[model samples]
Target chain A: MSDSPVQRLFAEPGLEWRSVSPKLTIERRLPLLGLLLFGLALLAFGRFVAEQSEAAGADLTGALFSGLAAAALVGAVVGWFFVVPRVVSAWRYAEREQDLLVSRGRLVRRLTVIPYGRMQVIEVSANPVSARLGIATVTLVTASASTDARIPGVPVDVAQELRDRLAAKGEALTAGL
Target chain B: MSATDAAPAAATQASASASTLRRLHPLTPFFRSWQLVGALAASGFGVFRDDLDKLKWIWRALHGDVEVSLLMRAVGVLLLVALALVFVSWLSWRVTGFAIITDASPSGTLLYHRGLIVRQRSQVRLNRVQSVDVNQPFLPRLCGLAAVRLDMAAGEGASVNLAYLRRQDAWALRAEILRHTAVARSRPTAATDSTEGAGGELIAEISTARMVQANLLDGVVAWVVLVVWVVALVVGGVVFGWRGLVTVAPGIVPVTVGIAVQLRRQVASMMRDANFRLRRTPTGIQTSSGLTSTINRTIDLDRIQGVRLEEPYLWRRLGWARVGVDIAGASDQSHHGASLMPVADRRDAVALIAEVTGARLDEAAVVPAGAQARWLDPWVARHLGVELLDRGAVTRWGRWRRTQFFVPYARVQSVSARQGPVQRRLGLATVYLDMPSGVQRWQAQHRDMAEAAALVGELAGQARLHRAPLRRLEPTLGTGDR
Candidate 1:
């Protein structure tokens, strides 16, 4: 914790960075739940096809695929309990005087600082689960394709506010790409 | 042209008034179909080669041993094919035309119409044009004709090539197009350069000897390795005889064929331009080169985002280097067409880049990738590092070619720092300075994590400073042109 590079990289003195809503964890895991359901359906479909072809002799292939599917299901459950929380916690952003700084990721830390003038567009989106959870995703589009500056798990109203503020700042500093 | 920046209030009326489209020169079809005619003739000769063996058929026909009707039939067929090709080319030329139109935007648009039945149209905003070139292919040059190629700020296939314009008309069109581009086309850069005078200064001219030397040096390393490989194989063949030759034949065939193909390609590209010359022009920098079919290109200084200087190991002793640029506008399909100088003295090349783009070249200021990076790059790590300049940034790398890239901040599209798990454990990261697509990439690989992180803000800040004053600086100069 003391030697965290994310803190070292973006920790401007007296800066209080804004952290996204923690309820984001539940909304993020819904994808894993949907994936788990799809995997079960696929497993059953595979077995049904194997049974239709030869019934008895396909046991080895069936068991192998079943084992792989089971392992993946277990991994997803574990990530739902563990990985999702940390990733959701990692979404932090700070509005600077001239730029907006966003940082995420625990193991592979990512810090992106986009100048207000460089912003081409700001998009706020939400999935059904995210809508229910009152959370939205904010993406900052720049001329550079690789910017990939998106802050997820933001409170819906706050996301809208962030968009307006960013758009206003961008207009104020308006430099064309 | 003043109407280009005029208000968008009369957009409809402007486009209507400029609706009159102009066609290319009347000889467009003849000149454009010359290559097709040549191919048809070669194939005809190849097909009738047996009958025309040493002109025996000619002697036989004269004595009436051969039928004249058969010869007439073949000649008629050949004539029919050539005529059809010319007709098709003529149709296309008739359908193709261009017009300059101003729409709802403050900037003007170039409308190109082509295709006979389908009738396709493409509109390009005049402001996005990066560079314009006047190209005269050999046959066209002989006919006193040229092609105007406009490179936009878009990606691949972004070049709009209008061919077979009269030579002087091509130049006039290029000048007319530039007048509406983003640079405002008013003034040239400050002439604090060696060649003196304002613009049209002869910066560098690649001589025949230097061109040959640079080409040979480019392949010297690969040629040496290939020679050594062949020698070792020969020694093995001698020791092992027939059995060895058979076993090695498979490897030998592909390697030999591959080297030959690569060498041929290198030679062709190297000889593409014979007398390369770089000159300062009123609107930007002008580069004219080629043995036949002279090509004249103007690259606006404002559109240049980065410059790359490459010095091969063999070229180092001769103090020769190649300079290329990353344009803010759309890059050509093959960036080889974007070189400022094919081969020039290192000192002169450096001075030219500084004079034009104001990119300072100070190798000592760059900090090298630390000793630990040897585990990754081994040889090039020592050469890899980055330095920040007030106006731009410079990065040095490449083990053999020794490439140095100078990216001015104003042209930087984005800056990013990335670290994988291994780099994280080692406290290292790589930072890349993003430019427009199709440009050569520039980055500092495996540097101290802290330094790379600091660079993210610092690099972006430098861009802000450089681009702060004015985005519409007409003919932007290097010493804070605003």
Candidate 2:
């Protein structure tokens, strides 16, 4: 039960990976749901424009556009609802003796290991939607800006606790930059 | 040299002097604002339409010269603007000053303040200095003046620029800071590294002729451009009829000229790298070179994140290569900053990379990209691969210009291994070693899936080994633990 599917899939024998709360599924995918609506609205707009134009085969044009758009919409629905949850489920972190490991994504997987001493700052915040869902996101900034390290949809208390612990560890293991 | 002291030992004893606020050269205003004044004069009255109108009204009231020529009025406005700029520059220079805040610590802090009204102040700890350099632009050099650029560790676009110091004073300041840093670090051997008027032991030197020759003969890209252009012409002629190809043939002139311009630029940079010399300092390497605007660059050995050697195909036969280094906080906007060796013997370039990163390429350990990687870039992927050493990782990639980058484990911010759907199908992945921004990043591209995974793990393990291992994070090893 402790082993995430991602940990088992990308197995490093001794490392024990910790997955985020299952609630992240809803929190991560809500914006995608909005994106899906936006796509539908764009399709409708295309059909409206097609109907208004005096071009030949306007209905045909509308049908062809709608068909491609509908197909894309269906594919997105499958990806957002089905493929995305699995990716979210795969999201995990492991705090080793010296460094922290964060791995996520399914089709194009990424695992980043950043040293505790390299952490410059740690931030924990929650938007209204996430706050209502009782969760917050923790972001870690290091001297190198591009090494993305974020743990999303952790319970608010858990996020705060993790941030404090990380800051303490970073201070205790302070290495000159 | 007349008023300012030039003795290295005296400078060291003074220790950048916490007691006195040293001002910039009196001619600093003239040198700094000349470019601004010239720009305003060139723009004439075109720059500020409203200001010009106001100036005209003031002139009509004061001079009562409605008969003044338009050109004369424009020239008058330009002269006024230039004068104002010069005045502002002088005032700003008067306010701009720096002093050592505390020499109590072996490694002290320098406080710099500038601006007449807005007034900005920043302090840089000597111990945190990544590197320092003396940059003398053409005008400043003519004036016997120089600017010192001090780079600090983990600086967020913040660097100390002390402009228009007398040349001796600049060198004295450099020596003082280096001595202070060495004293603070308890490295007595490094204390005598920066002596005024003396460069470190010369490691390598590139003659002006050799630099000009190598840069001008920089092939591969130039040749490729020619071949590709010819091929385009021929292919177009065959496909679209000779007449049509002729119609589009004029396009080739621009492309050809563009390539010529690129070659000219290479020659121009060669002039910049003229008399390129590399010396081994106690703390790092110092490069001093220039034809007109000379630059003296020092790169801290400990702050070196990545190093690369570039061997153009044409240079390969000539046994010439160039070495580049990425130092944290070292400015790379100018080609002069990152370049360690613009032109050197191939063996010397290799040795330079080894000296900096403590890693050398081993033919046995090199994992070359397989034919599968040919899909990446037919010209480049065949030569692409990575070599892992105890001290760092060496990534070799590039087509006609073979580049090898060494990223030491100590400076790696993070390790990442990623595989796309195609890479997954191909059983390959790319591993990236993250470094500070504005520097070249290293990647082990097109490695076997398992090898990539192992490489990531190995890198992470090596990175931890370089630093002190922390106490374990978990107490009870709850649900997250096995």
Q: Choose the strongest candidate by TM-score.
A: 1
TM-score for the A-chain in each candidate structure: 0.82, 0.81
Query: B250 in model 1: Cα distance from truth in Å?
Result: 5.3
What's each prediction's TM-score? 0.82, 0.81
Score chain B of each candidate by TM-score: 0.80, 0.79
Please state every model's RMSD to the true fold in angstroms. Answer: 5.9, 8.5
Give the per-residue Cα lDDT of candidate 2 at A40.
Answer: 90
Q: Give lDDT per model, in order.
A: 0.74, 0.74
* lDDT digits (tens) for residues A123-177 of candidate 2: 8989988898998888888767678888887889888888898999988776533
lDDT by residue (B63-86, candidate 1, tens digit) is 878788977886788789889989
Q: On a 0 to 100 scale, what is the lDDT of residue B172 in model 1? A: 71
